[model samples]
Target: MLPRPVVPAAATTGALLLLAACAPTVPVTAAPYATDPVCAAVVLATPDSLGDGLDRVATDAQATTAWGEPRDAVVLRCGVEPLGPTTERCESVTTPNGPTIDWVIVEDDGDWTFTTYGREPAVQLLVPGAVAESRSTSFVDALGPAVARTEQLRQCL
Candidate 1:
């Protein structure tokens, strides 16, 4: 057999680095109550995709997940502190075949953040403007089952 050419150490290192960079992982900060058992259920119940080609992506934090491209992903973080009465826009969402969930809506710079109203270990969703506009309630409805895993103590009146 002919002698094989050996790759240089630097070239091998560079190639490995390039491969590592190609693997996408969305950066997410774990919520304060991330370790709560309820959060585990929420994460487990989350859908693999949010429709419109938004597939689930790996996350760097516990009880956190993201869907869609990293640059414009829809992020979900479980185990946030529960919300008491709030003046923020709240809505009661009833999914077609899932449980009804209450969410407090907040908008910042065209991005929408929705948090479960009164669940002990609340779930938060950071939705990009474009995706929210296109999917509207569909995305939230898709997540209702997961969010519903937590016990809701209050709702929009």
Candidate 2:
């Protein structure tokens, strides 16, 4: 009688497929704004806190060119109507690849105070309204914090 052939466990079909399906999936996410608490600190900034020439953050022609032609970076403003003027807290990226700066700007105010997180103690805060808004790294780390803070302040007013 011919010897019976044996099938090895490693040769089993669909084992690889099963393993692939079981592997964890990690969604790709954008990088946070500098990972510094100072950059993330937008709520503390007030109109009174800012000095002169803070409004035109990236407007200088020379600066603009270096920052990729000055694209209209998204600005998250809370505490008041977006277009209408008020003491709304605002945060935006100065340039596409530049640092993310937090600003507390009020209408008719000459001083536009801004803050940027630097390397040091890293403190991460979840924006108050993060769940309601579309989740983005920038929003979660920077925009959300500022907007959430402004919203909180607006509720008081």
Candidate 3:
């Protein structure tokens, strides 16, 4: 009968070190985005405004496009722009009149959903009828330019 000999600690350690040296290390790059004045103005928007702080505009637009709804009345601001194959950049503000601001860059599959809470009530406008009509128009007015700028940004990339 024969017994196997144990390897010495130094030899085992050297073999392990050699194996570790052969392993690969991958480098991850940063997400693609531009932080210029035009992009920032549109991307870093607040409630009652439209801009690019978020990256889900394209997702919203795709959902909107699929929904086939011209526009959502409940949404104080609606804007969309593309960002590669599986992502989109979006910024929206549902204010005191409407009541919350959401800036997001959703990724892949159009399956994300979450509810947000705010201090103010979720009314489309503080007042109703003609007064609200004026307000809604104002929202569109403020949001339009930002949305347009975002659209141009999508092309830039």
lDDT winner: 1
The candidate maximizing TM-score is 1
1-157 per-residue lDDT for model 1 (tens digits): 9999999999999999999888799998999999999898899899998886799988899999999988788999998888889999998888887799999999988799999998878999999888777766467888988888898787788
**Candidate 1 residue-wise lDDT at 75:** 95
Model 2, span 5-74: residue lDDT tens = 9877776657776876664332212224333333234423322211121121222111010111113222
Count of steric clashes across candidates, in order: 0, 2, 18
* Residue pairs in candidate 2 whose N, alpha carbon or C atoms collide under 3 angstroms: 39-116, 39-117
Off by over 4 Å in 2: 1-69, 82-140, 151-157
Using lDDT as the yardstick, the better of models 1 and 3 is 1
Model with the higher lDDT, candidate 2 or 3: 3
- Judge candidate 3 at residue 24 and give its lDDT: 39
lDDT per residue as tens, model 3, 1-157: 8999999999999999998666432221211232233434543342332232211221131112111111222232222222233234434544434323333333234223211111111111111232233333234233333333332222211
Q: Give TM-scores for every candidate, taking all chains together and pairing residue i with residue i.
A: 0.83, 0.19, 0.22
Q: Which is better, 1 or 3, measured by TM-score?
A: 1
Candidate 3 Cα outliers beyond 4 Å, as residue runs: 28-157
Better of 1 and 2 by lDDT: 1
